[model samples]
Target: MPSILLISDIHGNFPALQAICTQHPPEQFAHICNTGDCTVYAPYPNQTLDWLRTYQAISIRGNTDDKIIRLLKGQTFKKPGKKEKRIMYTSTAESLTSENSAYLLHLKKKQVLKLGSYSLGLFHGSPADHEEFLFDNTPEKRFQEIASTCKYDIIVTGHSHTPYHKIISGIHFINPGSVGRMFDGNPAASYAVLTIDEQARQKIQVQHFRCHYNTEEVVNELSRMKLPEIYGIMFKQGKKLN
Candidate 1:
């Protein structure tokens, strides 16, 4: 079967990242497409980068990832609140390691790949804005606007931190949500394994894979390290804490 591993907003939670791999296993995907933000929030920056490197996923730069890279370049970062400060410190401090800094700095912004019969465009936010968040509540008119500028059988976007799929005018738009920082009430570091094919008669079929991870492990790790932003509570509830 032709398959794609769609992930985003890993945010440094290594256990959830591990759980995703353990559940799907690398053997399952034809390709792993990450929509960025792999280096903040949680406590496993290097580990997260290592896993992505293992697959050498087609990654696009996220807004958060951009900020991390900026810090690595010794550029001044915006003053974050207490929670945001924790994220800044972790990402900045952990990334001082040359490997992490260089890796993040060199990540590509976006790409379009052909998967069998489908054209898949990978981007962190909208094609127009890498950080422009299109949420479930985004107006349909905006969706129409996004559809107008991008051409692909499927458009894969992350940043809203929600897993959703909706087909408009024959274009399939998908957000795999946060692979390591889900706010889906159960906090399993949600992601999607999408299997699409033309229906025998003539149409597309989509299957959404929503999996749950061990929230306690994430919470425990957060508490153990005292990571910033009280992110643990949000993940536990499966929604954005900040």
Candidate 2:
């Protein structure tokens, strides 16, 4: 079986990121792909970048990645409320190296791959837009429409910070979810492994997985940065802080 790892939306949670890396033998997987958001939301943006860089991710730019890159390149930002803007700006200061910033800047919006009979398209959001997040809460008809627009047997994406799988229009759409934030009623860091064969051409195995980390580490780091304390609770609760 040809194997690939799908990771996404790692918003600078170092503990979660490191746990996931240790769960696997790097040589076992043929490739690792990410759907961006490699930084933001918590502390350790630079550390997370270093981890991904060490792994040599085949990455697609998520909205957060794009936004950060723009901000780092001296563009203006307006997301995350006024307080968050200040916090994010302060935290990311000196976090992005010139080369890493440029790497995020040049991340592809989409990726297409062909191996024997299998067809794959990878995007951070939807096929039409990198910022479009495909998620479990989305409408079924909308998924049908999105799947139809793409001419591939399998589509991979991330952004909702949740991991899920859908079969539509003879197409398999997969979201490995967020590696950093599961602030959606599940605290475990989530990802997926996809195994498929081109000659068999008809089978795809998607394994949605979650791994726990020392939430306090991330929380403490965030607290140290004066980021929203709720982020700490969110990591502990596995969802948005109540």
Best by lDDT: 2
Stretches of candidate 1 exceeding 4 Å from the true structure:
79-96, 196-204
Query: Tens-digit lDDT track for model 1 on 1-242?
Result: 56778888888777888888888897688788899988776777888888888887888788778877776766756555565554645454564567777788898878899877878888898888887888878888888888888788889899988778888767888888888776667676678777655555534445555566777776787677756546777777777655
Candidate 1 pairs with clashing backbones:
183-238, 183-239, 184-238, 185-238, 188-213
Q: Determine the C-alpha RMSD for candidate 1 after optimal superposition of all C-alphas.
A: 2.4
The per-model lDDT (C-alpha) reads 0.77, 0.79
- Candidate 2 Cα outliers beyond 4 Å, as residue runs: 199-202
* Model 1 worst lDDT run, 10 consecutive residues: 199-208
For 144-217, candidate 2 gives per-residue lDDT tens digits of 88877779988888877767888988899899988888867777788899988645665788898888888889
Backbone clashes (count) for model 1: 5
The Cα RMSD in angstroms, rounded to one decimal, for candidate 2 relative to the true structure is 2.0
Q: What residue pairs are clashing in model 2?
A: 183-239, 184-239, 187-238
Error of 2 at 44 (Å): 1.3
